[model samples]
Target: MLESLLDGIFNGISIGSVLLLAALGLAIVFGLMGVINMAHGELMMLGAYTTFVVQNGFKALGAPWSDFYIFFALIAAFIVTALVGLLLERGVVRYLYGRPLETLLATWGVSLILQQFIRSVSWQFAAGVGVFCLLFFGALWLISRRPDFEQIRGKAIAIMLPLSGAISLVVSNLLGQTYKFAVTLPWFGTQGVDVTAPKWLRGGLPLGGYQLPYTRVFIIALTILCLFAVFWFLNRTVWGLRIRAVTQNRSMSACLGIPTQKVDALTFAIGSGLAGVAGCAVSLLGSVSSNTGQSYIVDTFMVVVIGGVGKLVGSIVAAATIGIISYVVGSNALAPLVEFSPFLQGLLEFFATASMAKVFVFALIVIFLQFRPAGLFPQKGRTVDA
Candidate 1:
């Protein structure tokens, strides 16, 4: 009985670790920045795909390297997603800072675009994106650095946008037939892919006469590392202080020459990158598809909301609470405790199934929210915009 209880608790914590990873980024971006970025899930999807690509690259190098691909994949996922997040912020989000509705609509569109792009990514498509980003970022750089270029910033973008498309068409026509990768008759990447864990993480770790899966143990350890990293980054670093200062008072931070815009951008990038790391961990559990991020996005959001907006500790507490409750109820671990009452046993049997467990958890969260609307830990001041 003790063994069963411990197993359930461990499983619950393992689940919560994933939630912590997913929600850590959301808490920073959504809770701190107040941007309704609907594309956050898509960013996680992109991270998973990035991992797939990295793993394949290692496999191409043969067997010895494939086992170590995860280290590289995690780094690549973080960098790729962070860059994408930076682009989203600069291109769409910056323009719609205070307009939550517009940001939501715009990011949702971006999410769809990203999903389709991955589903049918071609060499030609890759070439076109490269050309576009080159021209686009180059023009922006020139405008920022050169006084004369600033006058034609709008004109540069207007011309460069179409010019890049034209260049892509030319490149595709000339070199498309030779350069081929996922050149499918219809679709190659749509079926999704799975990432096998390394040999070291494949087995179980014996603890208290009960075995705990190494993957779950690794994930829990990873969560603790990430949590500490966040704390150290936010509290022990110079940039973290700047992020906090800018978040608290943008105008004051700007006046103090803190580069508020840059801080906001970096903060968003960090959050998105953390989401990407979450994707890497997720790949260990199941197949990664275009819809992978969508599976956990809702639960992640709930965790952040229940944890308290902009409160890291709250996110931690809330994730653990929700994870434990969901796992216990779903697995019927509490059955023994309620075995004395026949009516209660029947009720538990009905509602304690895996599918029905989430409904109960959601309902509990809603009821909790009714009593404490600000969440478990409320922000001290007016952090969110009206």
Candidate 2:
């Protein structure tokens, strides 16, 4: 009985961590821009693909390097996804600002395009894209940092985009000649690829006479670190303050000399980059495919909505609440009490399964929102409140 309780709790926290990690960026992006970025999930898919590319690169290097690929994978994923986010924001999202419906339709199209794009391309092409986005976004970031260079930013970008693309193509083709990653699937294909864990992180840890997987523990720790980092950035840094200011009152922030557009672009990039990090973490647990992000997209959105848009504390509590409830309902947590009664036990058996658990969880969330539509932590700025 005690073991069941402990196990369920551990699973709940780990599951919640994954949900929270994925939702963090979505929360920020949705809250700040009011743009329903359907491509947010696709950005996550890009991160996973980036990690896979890094993994293959490490494999080509061989031995010790291959064993420690995850470190590079995480960084690469963030950079690649961040750059993609920047491009998406500058190209599509910015134009559609304050128009949520159009943003939704546009991003949804982008998401489908991204998924289909990956599905049709070779890993090498994908790798080249990852490289191109990284270099290009880095160049753009440098340009953005220099206020005096704003006049030439357009020409600079026009030159850099093609230059970076050419360089990435050459680089990926050169690397592809040495070693190649191949996939085969006749119709729908096989399951996705899996990421191997390094030596220190493999195996399980014993806690309260129960075994806790190291991956889960690492994920939980990563979630906490990410949450702390976000909080610190939003509270402690200059850019963070600018982001908060812009999110609250875009026009007011702009009037105050804040570069609201740049702030929006950077904030969107940060959120997308976090999704990339979540992808890296997730790859350690199971297979990753184009559809990987689709699985969590809806749930993460729910997390953001339930916690209140743009509310980190709300996200934390909401994710934890949903995670624990999902786990408990799925497991035989109520079986102990109903064991003596066959009728109740039979009824519990019907609902205490993974599929049924989700139904109950969703229903509960629906009911909760009925009572508090603005969520646990509603926005309180003059612009929002008004």
What is each predicted model's overall lDDT from 0 to 1? 0.84, 0.85
> Model 1, range 267-384, lDDT digits (tens) per residue?
9899899888888888888888888887887988898899988899999999998888889888888889988999988877877877798999999999999998989999986785
Model 2 scores what on Cα lDDT?
A: 0.85
Q: Which residue pairs collide, candidate 1?
A: none
**Model 2 per-residue lDDT tens digits across residues 84-191:** 999999999999988888999999999988887767666666678789989999899988888868798889889999999999989887767766544221111234
Q: How close is every model to the real structure, measured as TM-score?
A: 0.91, 0.82
